[model samples]
Target: MKQDIDIPKVEGVYVAIVNEYNDIYKTQDWNAYIINDNDDALEMVIIVTDGYSEDKITSKFRKKIDVLPKKSYAKIELMQEELFAVNNQFKVTYFKGNTMYDKVYTFRKNTINLKALQPVPLMEARGVLVK
Candidate 1:
């Protein structure tokens, strides 16, 4: 029964968009990252990301990470400036110990700008985070 199913609340994991300088390109770039702030390692992490709006939709990007250790972060992708006009989403799934956990993180249209950036947990840089 639906009421009998055990769905644990997801915590300590977050998706953030950070603005930083690129050494090779010599320009500031917008990038997405997955932060794991838990004490235990996450296994078989999968992320499906995309951006969309009523009139425009970006391509779907699927990323997989075999393992993400505690208190670490990984760069997911470099986001172009144009993509920020639409709503961006990251669907995340992973296993902690024997339990499976999942969550959807979304950045609303025009909300990924520098003005919205804040100190991201477990990361040194500041950026916008899905609340």
Candidate 2:
């Protein structure tokens, strides 16, 4: 048996982006986890699991900071040092019925776009990685 773990409650935000070009059978969904929120900015983390299709590909960079109240569509660049230094390690794992795949990616600086500022159900909304 595994012991239960208590995770600290950190103020954060949840953002979800839907690809405009998704077809009926397959819809592309991208999520951004922005934790440690403050007045001016929030810590953003993006994790991607599937890369078999162009619409499903995502960057492995972590710990990005996006200034709040940004312009409707602006680009924010992320640095590797800042991402990894914050104790964030890029990890990916996928499991099928009888097969499992796991991989780790090298840290690389990347940029993500802030799509818009909108209202989310229960948290602050910060749209990112709009394609």
Candidate 3:
């Protein structure tokens, strides 16, 4: 009789850290479908929270961060010398490719915006990073 050799299991966790606007709890591709020329139909949502174990966060949200919508564009401002934790507070500014000429705004750390001020165009968003 042939027997399978059992290997020891190693416990671990997986994580991905993104600056400012994080789409870790959603699965919609809100970034790819919008055009910069239009701002009214902008239904962009963004979330920023303290980082956690991938398995834990995924299960709580019932989805993978990969399914989360990518930012159309992001303006990241590093808070400290390093980004050590998901909860580490940092300022962020973003644009969805339609409203306000793509000007970025500083949002409170550890929070999210279910919508943007407007849909901003890519071209308009390019030079509008107000820092």
Candidate 4:
């Protein structure tokens, strides 16, 4: 049986904290925010919370510090946008080293769940990391 779902036309920033998959390299999770979405391109900012060399140390010892996130923009040509009416899933694709990948970002019950599809390396190395 086919079911229909309502996909909202959302415009604004969506934030999420994605953890590293156990199958791949076990590293610290990062935060990703969808800053803008349009027909031309999608702008996003990714923040590495921990597990990376650069994120491990702090400027002031025993003190709290704030770090800026990296900005990335993916063009329409390099991505495939899909809206699933069945589950209200919104996905975007990008390529890395000739391999394509998709990341699904969906809103449910006022919460956003974003997942990076298989071939995680490409997504971290190219898709969200690409400037």
Residue 120 alpha-carbon offset, candidate 3, angstroms:
20
For candidate 1, write residues 26-115 as lDDT tens digits.
999999999999999999999999999999988999999999999999999999999999999999999999999989999989998988
- Compared to the true structure, candidate 1 yields what TM-score? 0.94
Residue-wise C-alpha lDDT for candidate 4, range 1-131, written one tens digit per residue: 22553333434323232333334656443333332323333323222221112223212111111221223322221111221112222343332223333444543321212343222221352123211
TM-score of each: 0.94, 0.23, 0.18, 0.22
**How good is model 3 by TM-score?**
0.18
Q: Specify the poorest-scoring 10-residue window by lDDT in model 4.
A: 77-86
The clash number for model 4 is 0
Q: What is the lDDT of residue 113 in candidate 1?
A: 90
Worst lDDT run of 10 residues, candidate 1, spans: 1-10
lDDT, candidate 2, 7-126, per-residue tens: 333232222221232366464333433222233332132334222222333444433333333122222222222232222223333222233333333222222223343443333344
| 123: Cα error in model 1, Å | 1.4
Q: Write the per-residue lDDT of candidate 3 for residues 19-130, one digit (tens) a residue.
A: 2333775442122112212222223323233323333221111111212133333322223312222233222212333321222123233322233323233423212111
Off by over 4 Å in 2: 1-8, 21-40, 43-59, 69-131
Ranking by lDDT: 1, 2, 4, 3
Q: Could you tally the backbone clashes for each prediction?
A: 0, 0, 14, 0
